[model samples]
Target: MSNPHKKEQHTGKDLPRWGMVIDLDRCVGCHTCEIACKMENDVPLGIWRSWVKEIEKGKYPNVVRSFRPTLCNHCENPACVKVCPVGAAWQREDGIVMVDPHLCVGCRYCMSACPYEVRYVHPQKGMIDKCDFCHTRVDAGLKPSCVEACPASARIFGNLNDPKSDVSKLVSTKSVTTLKPEMGTDPRVYYIGLDMATMEIKREAKLVWEK
Candidate 1:
């Protein structure tokens, strides 16, 4: 009998889940990742699908700077999905949140519901737009454009369910925090090396705008 075991061999599934861990310390406040995401996604001008948010903290004499790259949190309990009058905005079982432009009525409800302000109504298309976490690229076994383009390797992507995965490992070893823990959205994106003062400023800004 020729190699029966070889013929019966099974191929394990490719990683299905996606999560990102951003190292705030390694980020140089360079907007390279943001630009890369825009270019890759072909997002329109005056409407960024991803962006870098800067926070300056301290008194007049001494100040500290911090940078945060913000995008759709892809929350486990996404408020956008709940508020959509139509079934346009939905989160996939694999954790990617997306919007169906064809079905969207452009009511902007989803935009208002997103606390992170990542969602925007497309100027021309009139449909709400936000980061899809590069679902197309993820399906192809490639990293998201931002993750691939980061020179500092500050953004790490992997399956959170897998304990051996890089994302899981980083979360285990580092001090990680999410954007709005109070909201209880259960955001999957984790940030490391974040300054508490900088986070407070961001929270204050979000509260004022209600975005």
Candidate 2:
């Protein structure tokens, strides 16, 4: 039932490159995003799809806590995809990194390869799972649950390929940084006003491989 008059659809480079931005200035370390993600994704009780990591600095009276929200970076050059022997770890044309549960054998090879240590084994499903930026909702013309649930509107999600997109504008204009940029993954997730102390504290023991 081919429609001879059907219009051509955009593909490859023309499609939207999904990305996210976390504005630390607006974030309150509330863990609301994590709870929203867990509820929306049906994640196992012992694990989380995302979380807000808090780190304290300075003396008691002058102490300050910084927050780093963690999730799948969905990199342009993903280490997981490279190390997945079965090709279970794959990326969309729009740059969303996803694991095909049907193809994944729970080998945990991708887990060892991921520098960010975001992927986790589903306790019941025995498959590696991580955030997919809520692609289903994106295709339905909606935002990711975590983004929509941010009480302070700290998270911004949009097509990075579009110059007019919020993510694109912010990344281009702000002093943003990504985790482990030196690793060459070229992560799409960006953070403004990120505290290196928090990043260091969070990655202290989770990294499986030496830099």
Clashing pairs in 1: none
lDDT, candidate 1, 1-211, per-residue tens? 3221112211234535568999988998888888999899999887788788788877887978888888788887788887888778877767778898767889998888888888988888888889998999988988999999999998998888788999999999998999887887889899998766655533344344545
lDDT of 2 by residue, 138-200 (tens): 889999999999999999999988999999999999999999999999999999999888866
User: Which ten-residue region of model 2 has the weakest summed lDDT?
Assistant: 1-10
Q: Report how far off residue 210 is in candidate 2 (Å).
A: 21
Candidate 2 Cα errors over 4 Å, as ranges: 1-12, 201-211
Q: Among these predicted structures, which one has the highest lDDT? A: 2
lDDT of all predictions: 0.82, 0.89
Name the runs in model 1 displaced over 4 angstroms.
Answer: 1-15, 59-61, 200-211
